[model samples]
Target: MDLNQILAQLETANDEEIKSLLQQYNRENSHTFSFEKRKKACAKLCQSVLTVLGRQVQPSCQKTCLETLRILSRDKSVLAPVATRKGILGEDTQSEEEERVVVEALKCLCNVVYNSPAAQQVSVDVQLANGLCASLRNAREWHHEVGLFTLRLLFLLSALIPDLRGSLRREWRAVRLLREVLEHTLDVRWVGPYEAARPDPQALPMPAEDNERAMEVLKALFNLTLSDPGGEDDHQFRLIAALLRHLLMLKTETEEKQRKHTGDKSIQNRF
Candidate 1:
């Protein structure tokens, strides 16, 4: 169906129709669309999707709406303003109802943050990083997808909004958490007195979950240390850098190795 048909159907669409229309993106995303198409889709469907989410829909339907928005958010132009104005990024990211919904929302959020430089400025204005940090702190335990996406969002904020790094480090002490997460996720047992001694591992099977989370934490730390290390962070930087060194030394995943683990575990996680 075309955009107009999709929008028209969405207007009166019940749970299944809404899901079917939204699910189109699952395949469409694998191909590229023009800017005009994505912009048009975002302009027309942002409110449509949000309205569906606001209704007392079934958890399954709400999940689809959020997932669709997450996919569409790659447009990052029209969706950014509409999403921000709707208070999407500024709102409590952890959904009250369902964990999957929260994960989808966070993915949508990461897209908006990563794809739009304008969104970065808007996020800084709305103190989006502060909100993300608060949520990250509240999540003392890793809720897998939720925690992973939260770290990814924070990493995007740190990398995209250059001005926000110092505050993330000093104001939020975000570096400490990044350090802790990287260490815990990678089973990086520091050998020496402090982080000055980095992880040195031989053969390790990086769990899919740990691999993704550690990558995000590393990215955030790398972004924070882009400049000369501040006096307060010199030691921490050394430790994080050591972790990076260890990751780099990790043996490449052979083609056979990659083929072995090419299962549907990640696909199952979406639901």
Candidate 2:
């Protein structure tokens, strides 16, 4: 179907139909619709999806709309609204459903910034940087998944916009939040698959995903420190200490496992 026809259908379609059409447009190898054509209709499609996101829709519907927005975010026209919408980044995101929407909105914004410097400018122009900072602060008390997603989005935006470093450092208080998260992760001894295989009785087991998220936050802080160098004295020292401690633990555990395996091999050989 043509872009106009699809847009027309979207105007009247229910949640399920809108989702199906959006999914069809997002398909990489769709014979019926071209991304080039869809690009022309991105503004309209984005508006429709944004409307869906604003309402009390099914989780599946919300997810589909979010995925569509991520695709549409390649266009600055579509991305600006996604980034700047107060509803997307607002304090109302306390429930799991609301958090999902906020996470998706941030992801869409992240995609736009990651894809185009022009979109980054749009984001800044629309004050998306401030909005993101607010969202980050709010998500700190939310589910860890939400917090991780927010951090990932912030990392992408800061990486793209050089000027954002100062804003995040001062206005947003990103460094403090990142440090807090990193310290929390450090306190929890993360015994993952490898640790389980080795069976370290001393280690406290944490979910592998939690450990992965913590590492991602640490990497984000490291990336931020690379560009903005002044504020890292205490934060950097603590981060490095935590990292070194974790590495040393891993090394000690691995060596212990290796020695035990070697001793078992030697005994078998002697027998």
Candidate 3:
């Protein structure tokens, strides 16, 4: 029941044992495992979990470790080390397992920044914004899900720290990357895999998940604009155009679906 003992056990634990320890650590809400005991071991435990995350471990074990980090990130003392870790943003050519670890790391970072001012300060002090922007820029070639999680993290950071918006807007590459994603979404058509053989020029369908990811990018851009109004004039125009185009495409797709379902061509061309 001692937190230090748990930390020592976790250090040498196998995947199954690691998962068990993490689950028990996550559930330590009783008076026996008091807040003082947790605070005493929080940093060491978080460091151990982060070390595990850096290893070539099983995806499930990595996930459990990340879940533990997510919980520990609520403590201000743990945020700095977690945010400053080098390998948290897996390499561009990472395997699927590595990519999942990166996504979970981003999610853990997002939780760290959500409503914790201490964590926010640690993030800014450690230059976490630059790291997140790097992830966004590199994501063009990395896994799509990596980009999605990066955007989500940026959105949360911008929302939590008002000053971040100005800094992000000044990062021209990040702004440009968001614009490119929006433009791609505008060209997407909602078609399935079986229907992709013909390759319609005017209607190239993107996976629905891609569209959702693009929307997350847009949301981040919108959040940035709310605090930093001096986005480049050309980039601003492109963002607006891309948003309008995406909305029109969404409307057209919705109408097509309604027409097919209800057998009514005149389903209110209203938008």
For model 1, which pairs clash?
Answer: none
- Local accuracy by lDDT, each model: 0.68, 0.59, 0.61
Worst 10 residues of 2 by lDDT: 262-271
Comparison by lDDT, 1 against 2, better one: 1
* Residue 57, model 1: Cα distance from true site in angstroms: 2.7
Candidate 3 structure quality by residue, lDDT tens digits, 175-201? 666766665655534344211122354
Predict model 1's lDDT versus the native.
0.68
Query: Cα lDDT of model 3 overall?
Result: 0.61
lDDT of 1 by residue, 13-50 (tens): 89988888888855566354335645866666877777
Each model's Cα RMSD: 7.2, 9.7, 8.3
Over 4 Å off, model 1: 24-30, 35-38, 80-83, 90-96, 138-140, 195-204, 241-271
Ranking 1 against 3 by lDDT, winner: 1
Best lDDT among the predictions, by candidate number: 1
Off by over 4 Å in 3: 1-5, 11-16, 23-44, 51-60, 72-97, 188-207, 227-231, 251-271
Candidates ranked, most accurate by lDDT first: 1, 3, 2
* Clashing residue pairs, backbone N/CA/C < 3 A, model 2: none
* Residue-level lDDT tens digits of model 2 in 172-250: 6777766566556545353442131233557654455555565556556655566435555455444444443453343
TM-score of 2: 0.66
